[model samples]
Target: MAAGCQGCRTAQHQFAIAMAFQPIVDVETGLPFAYEALVRGEDGEGAADVIARVTPENRYAFDQQCRVAAIEGAVAAGILDTSARLSINFLPNAVYSPVACIQLTLQTSKATGLPVDRLIFEFTENEQMADTSHVKNIVDSYRKMGFGTAIDDFGAGHAGLGLLAAFQTDYIKLDMELIRGLDTSMPRRMIVEGVLRIAKSLDITVIAEGIETLGEYDVLRGMGVRYMQGYLLARPGFKTLPPIALPGELYAAVA
Candidate 1:
């Protein structure tokens, strides 16, 4: 473990944090591919409510604890019996040493009887990471350990093609900003087309999240984007894995 992270490992969180799961579905197959664990509060508060309390001092501990909590919560909710993987969002900046930071997660996975391959670690571009090398190390280390890595919010923030060039991740979730008006916006479609081409060339899977309308879903489905997540499909269930619903036509096709 890095010396800088020692203090954070022992730090305690002031507020309670809970886990909510949102399903990521394979649109073509009309089946859930994974469930992304979202942070929530004990009193039914949103993620922003809990995020507002994370300071630099408590970030590492918070990050570490979130992993354990997500896995434990998923197991308690019977995720182990499902074929879908458990996707957990992580903070690259909070990880001092990827190898060291993952020990607890590994332990939790083993205790819950969830194989390491069943976990997918996702990180967004929202975090302002100072050291790109550290992030690369974390990604590479996790990949080496046989866990899936994903870049969340692909087009919404700091990391994009630049980060993709540095590290080839297993998945990239297209940001909702790009998907917001995709059904009507030619520019957005053009951009997504370009991104899709690049992802295909890189052998990375593209998941369009935050889908809420049939139009958006139709457009993406027509474009051959197989994976999707959003309220239109299923909202995040509190401490549970929600069932997925697909359109009748598409459901029949996939079925």
Candidate 2:
């Protein structure tokens, strides 16, 4: 193993995983909203570096540890309750072992006494589905268990609309790159509009990610985007979120 990998392995086993809460706000109401738990490795190594050292051979282990740590940390900190939904990012490869992931998550919830329905699993756009049948099966199992699944970076990957049509996703998060500069780009606006239309037809909720300015928020709001996440609302940090209210007008207009 490379020095970095060797060092990371030792650190990974002993490292404390900390949870940071990033508020997912209702685009129209502009209020504090759902909290997505961001995981960080706390062993004097940056998270990016730690993730890089995680190989396909050990990806499942790495991700499971992170998930468990995030849940435990959140519950211990009193950030998770019956009313609060906890969103956690899961790599595509992790879904290959979906049963294990689901089991671990459910076990955490049971141990913490938090409802499984309040946990949201967010998968990135780059995850390749080696077996669609297996992916669907895993999704179905989680749904049966009352957990929600979200596809992250919806527009930037190979899956795009096809994945939405194929998988049963509760939420589709638009890529930040797509949301950036959307106010000035008609093409971008049109693409987002198309996504919103598709999502509505499928009954899937859409969330715009990486909004840094009111201009972007206003443009998305006008485009019928109902949920948003970006620096403008709140950055990802360790603080617990305050109460969040979804904008009634935005939902009405979208409806």
Best by TM-score: 1
The lDDT values for all models are 0.87, 0.71
Candidate 1, residues 1-255, lDDT tens digits: the string is: 465356445554556988999999987778889999999998669999999999887778788778888999998988878788999999887888887778778988999889999899999987766888889899899999999999999988786788888888899999999999899999999999999999999999999999988889999999999999999888999998887777775457566
Candidate 1 clash total?
A: 0
Candidate 1 residue pairs in clash (backbone atoms < 3 Å): none
Candidate 1 global CA lDDT score: 0.87
Clashes of each: 0, 1
lDDT of 2 by residue, 1-255 (tens): 243234333434433556667778865556544678776656434567667677766666677677777677667766654355778887655554455445666676799877777788787767777666766776677777787888888888877777777786888899998999988889999899998888888898998999876668789978777778887666666634434334454345467
Off by over 4 Å in 2: 1-16, 28-32, 43-46, 95-97, 239-255
TM-score of every candidate relative to the true structure = 0.94, 0.82
Distance from true position, residue 254, model 2, in Å? 28
